[model samples]
Target: MNPKASPGHALSIIPREQHTISRKNISKAALRVLYRLNEAGYDAYLVGGAVRDLLLGGHPKDFDVATNATPDEVKKLFRNCRLIGRRFRLAHVVYGNEIIEVATFRGTSDEEGDRHVVDGRIVRDNVWGSIEEDALRRDFRVNAMYYDISDFSVRDYVGGMQDLHNRVLHLIGDPATRYREDPVRMLRAARLAAKLNFRIDPKAAAPFAELGPLLSGVAPARLFDESLKLFLTGHGLKSFQMLEGCGLLKFMFPATARAIRRGDRALCMLIEQGLENTDARISEGKSVTPAFLFAVLLWGEVRDLAHTWMSHGKDGNDAWSRAAAHVVSEQCQRVAIPRRFTIAMEEIWALQPRFEQIQRKKVFRLLAHPRFRAAFDFLLLRGAESQAMEELGRWWAHAQQLPHETLAAALPAQHVGGDVDTGVPAPARKRRRRRKPAGKSGAS
Candidate 1:
C-alpha cells in the first residue's frame, strides 16, 4: 500500500507471468513463508539479487523477501521467525533446513539527529526507509529488481531490467552518494560483476577509484562477512580478478596486491590453485573454513617475511612463526578474525615446520592434531602451484593414506641425530658447585 511504490503503466500492464515469476527453483519453505505473509494481509514481494539471479537462469543460493510488515510484526506471524541485526532490522525465518531472510523495505534516514557518523574509521549503518526508497537504496540496478506477487509484474524504478538484459552492473541513483553511504558497495560491485560475468556500467565504474578509500571505513566484521561472500563462494578466482582490475583488492589485502602488481606468477598460482580447491570442495558440498582460505591467501606474504627473518639467522620454525603472526595481525586490522578462526590459523601455521620432520611417531602425532588436515591441504595446494617440493607433498599424501600400523613403519624414526654431551668429569673448582646451606655450606 505504499503510494510511492505504485507501478507505472509499463510495469502495471506487464504480463502476469512476468510479475508472478516462478518460485519453482525457490525453496518450498521460503514460498510457504512468503505466501503465508501475503495471505495474512502484509504486502510481500521477492526482491534483490535473488530475483536477479532467477531471471538470469541461475539457481539462487537463497531466497529473500521484502515486506511492508515491520520486523516485530513478521516475527509475530511466524513462530520460526527470529529478529536479527540492529543497524538495519531483519527477520530470519528459519525453515529448519533453510533460512528465508525477510527484510522490510529500507528508506534513507532523515531523522532530527546526525544520520551518518564515523567511529574512527568505521561507519555504523542504521537506516530505515520505504519500499520505493529501499529499491533505490540498493548498490546496483540489477540488484534492485522486485517481483510483485500482487499483479505478477516486475517493477523497474532504476532501469534494472535493462541492465540485466545488457549483462551490465549498474549503480542505482548517484554513484558517488551511494558509495559514500556504504563503501562495501564497491567491493560488492566487483563481486557481482565477477559472479555474473557482467561488465560494470561505465558510470558505476567511474567513482570506484576515488571512492575506494571509503572501504577502510567499513567495519572489520562486515568486511569479514563480505570477504567470505567474495572468496569462499564458488567464483572466488574470478572475483579476485575483478577486484584487482578495479583497484579494490588493496583495500582487503594490501600484500597480495603488491605481489600481483610485482608480476609474481608463483604467488598468483598459489592463490588461484587454493581458490580452485575451495571451489571444488564447495561444489561437492564439502566444508571449507575461512582460516584455511586466509592462510593460503597470506602464504606468499608469509614466505617473504620468513625469508627476511631467516637472513637474520632465525631458524625456519621461528621465521615462519613470526611471519604468520604478523600476517594474521595485519589482516585482522582489515577484517576482524574471530578468536576461533585465529586459533585455527595459528595451529595451521605451526604445523608447517613439522611437515618436514617425517618421523613416524611425530607424523602420527601431528596427524592427530586438529589442524593437521587443513595444513596438509594447504601443502598440497602449494605443490599444485609450483614444481618445487612436489615430491614432499606427494609423499605426505601417500603416507596419510597408510593404515596406522603401516604409517608408523613408513615414517622415519624420531630423534636419530646426536646430541652434544656436556659432562663434568670431576668436581668443580668452586665448592664442587654445591649450593650453600644456611651459613656453612660454602666453607664445607
Candidate 2:
C-alpha cells in the first residue's frame, strides 16, 4: 500500500491481499447493492462504521454504501429502493429485515445545491460532489475510510488506519467547528470511546466541556434515540462513566447528575449495578426493555423526592405518585422518553413501597400485578442501598420459590397497623358485645 494524490487529497489504497476483510463476512444484502451499483457503472464502496468494524475484525450489524449516483438515479436501478430524509437525502434498499443505506457523496461547497445553515448548524444538506469531498465531510477519521467493492481494496484518506492501530479516536477538521455543526457529535465521541475501548485524542476531547451545553438545544426525540444506542449496546456502564468523565452527563441528564453530586453513594451503586445487569442480559441474548432502563436511570431522583414529600407530612402513596410525576415530567424535557416507557417506570417505582407490606392479601395482590416481575428485578437492584434492603430482596426471592398457598399461609393473616419491616403487628381491634336494652325499657 502506498499514498497517491487524488484531486486534492492523499489517498492510501490497501490492496485486497493486504487487508483481513473477506466478502463472506459481509451481509449478503450489502453485497447485492454494491454489485448492482457497480454493474450500473457508478462508483460504489462500503463506507462508514461498517467498514471500520470490518477492518477491526468485528461483524457489524448494519452496512452503508456511498456512491456517485444520486438518490433518484439509485432508485431507478433497484425496485426495492426508497428515498428518505430531507436533512440529508438517502436511499434505503430493503432486503427483508436488513436495510442497505445508500448515500450520494456529499460536496463541500454550498453554492451548487440545496444546503441550509442556521446559527452554525447544518439543518439541510443535499450537495453532490466527488468522493474526496465526502471523506473530508465525515465526523471522525476512523469512520471516513471506504472499502472499494469493485477492486476489493481499502481506501484511507484521513490516516484512519493509523489511528485505529493506536486505538485512539481522532476527530476530522477543527473540533470546535465540527461540534458546532452538530452538538450530538460530542455525545457520539463519548459513546464510541466506550463502545470500542479507544482513547480520545487530546485535541478532540478538549472542546467537550465548553461545548457540552450545546446538547440542550438538540431535539429531545433525537436524544432519545441516541440514548438507546449508548445504554442498550452492551457497554452502558462504560458509556455512563465516559459521559461523566467528559463532563457531559449533566447536560444530557440533569436529575441523575444532581443526585450523584449530592453524595448519594447508594444511588450511584444502584445505577452502576443496574447498567451492569443490563449489559449482562444483552450479552446473554436475553430481551431487554427501554422502560426498565429508563426506570433505573431515574430512580434516584424519584426516591429522594418521595422521601422529601413524606417528611413534609404527605400521604405515602400520594407522595410517591407526585414524585414520580414530577421527575418524569422534568426528564421528558431533556430526553423525551415516550409516554409508554414513562408509565412503566412510574409503576416500577410505585411497587417499591408495596414490598414492605407482608400481609397475606397485599402479598398476593402484588404477586398478581402485571408489572411484578420487572418491579421485583428492580427491587433487587436496591440491595446497594442498605443491608436491610438486601435482606428484603432475599425475602422476596424466597417467597417466590414457595408454593402460592404455602407463601400465603406464612404471611400475617390481617394487616394490623405497625411497621411490617420489624415483623411487629399492631394491636388487633377488640370485639364488643351488644347490650339487651329492649328488656330494660319494657321493665321501666
Candidate 3:
C-alpha cells in the first residue's frame, strides 16, 4: 500500500495482476505520454476517470495523465503539447486525431484573489502539488485512483476501488463542502451514477438538492459544455432521470423541468423519444445535432407560449416564430447554446404545425426543407402521447411513400396550403437528393 501517501487519507495499492488494465488496451497516444514523462524522471500516472473506467472493464475514449510536472514543464517535454485552461492549467499532447490530456497534480492555490476564485467556485487554480495532494483534491472517490506506469499497479487513495466494487459513487472529502467548491460535481455525480449504473452514497446524494442552485452561479459556457456531457452523451435518458432524481435538472434546464414536473406526457414523450433516438444513432455510428436536442427540450415551453400567442389572435406561424425566439433567448442565458443551433432549433419548432398543411406540393417542399426530418421525428414522439398525433404521424409516414396523385387523393378535405402551386407529378420535378454533409456524430 502507498501508506496514507497524502494528508488525512487512507490508501491501497492493487498490483498490476489484481487489475484488468493492460497497455494494449490503452490508446497508443496515452502510452507514449506515460513513457515520455517517465523517461524525463517526473512522477506520472494514468489517472482519474480513465483509470476508474479501465478498472470497471470499459474502454475510455480519453486517457488523462496526472503528474508532478507543471504544465509548462510538461509542455516543454512534448512538441505537440499545448497549454490550455485558466481555471486549471493543463497540457494537451496532441497526436492528430488523438489527444492525451495531461494535468499536473493539484493543490490549493497559494493565491485566492480574483485570479483564482469567484463567488466560492475555483475558477483559476493552477497551484501544483504531489500526486497524493492531487488525489485528495479530486471530486469523487472513484475518480481519484491512479495507474502507475513504472510498476503497473493501481493506487487507491480514497477507497475508490471499494466504491467501484460496491457499485456506489461517493464524493471525496465532505460532500457539502466539496459540492460548494464545484457545483458541477453534483451534475457529475448524477451523470457518473447513471453512466456506470451505480448508486450514489447517501451522504454524496444528500446535499444535491440544496446545493444545485450553486450551478446557477457557474459560467454559462462551462454549463453549456457540461450540458453536452449530460445530454448528448450516449447515456442521456438515464442521465436525465438521475438529474431529475437529484433535483438538479430544473436548475440546469428550467423549462424542460417545469414541463416534466407538470406531468406533461407529450413533453416527456418528446424528451424520452429524442434521447432514445439519439442513443440508437450513436450506437449505429450515425449523426445527431444540438438543434434537434434543443428543439425537443424546449418544445413544451415554446408550444405553450405559441398557443397563448395564437389565442391572443396572432397568426399561428407568427406566434410560433415569436415563441421560438423568446424560448431560445431565455435558454441561452442559462446555457449559451450557439447561434447556429438556435437557428436550426427555431426552424424545427416552426416546422411543426406545417405538418398539418400536407398538400402534395406542400409535402414536397416540406420534404425538401433541411429541418423536415427532425420535425417529422418530433411529430412521431408527439404521436406517443396522443391518438390524434399518432394518426397525423401515420398519415405523413404513408404519404411519403405514395405516388403524387395517390397522395393528393389521400389528403384530407382541407385544402393544400403552400405557394398556391397545385403540385406536379413525381416525374415533373427532377430534384437533387438531399444528402447532409458529414458532421461530428452525437454533437447533440
Best by lDDT: 2
* lDDT: the better of candidates 2 and 3: 2
lDDT of 2 by residue, 1-444 (tens): 443333434688889999988999899999999999999999999999998999999999999999999999999999999999999999999999999999999999979898998988899999998888898899998999999989999999888888899999999888999999999999999999999999999999999889989999999999999999999999999999999999999998899999989998988998999999999999999999999998888899999999999999999999999999999999889999999999999999999999877778998899999999999999999988988787778878878888987776667777654432333333455656867776576365
- Ranking of candidates on TM-score, top first: 2, 3, 1
Give TM-scores for every candidate, taking all chains together and pairing residue i with residue i. Answer: 0.82, 0.93, 0.89
Among these predictions, the greatest TM-score belongs to 2
Supply the TM-score for candidate 2: 0.93
C-alpha displacement of 438 in model 3, angstroms?
65
The models' CA-based lDDT, in order, is 0.76, 0.90, 0.83
Model 2, total clashes: 0
Model 3 has an lDDT value of: 0.83
lDDT of 1 by residue, 98-155 (tens): 9999987776666732245553222444455667778767778788777776666677
Give the lDDT ranking, best first: 2, 3, 1
Q: Which runs in model 3 stand beyond 4 Å of their true positions?
A: 1-9, 109-115, 408-444
For model 2, state the Cα shift of residue 63 in Å.
0.2
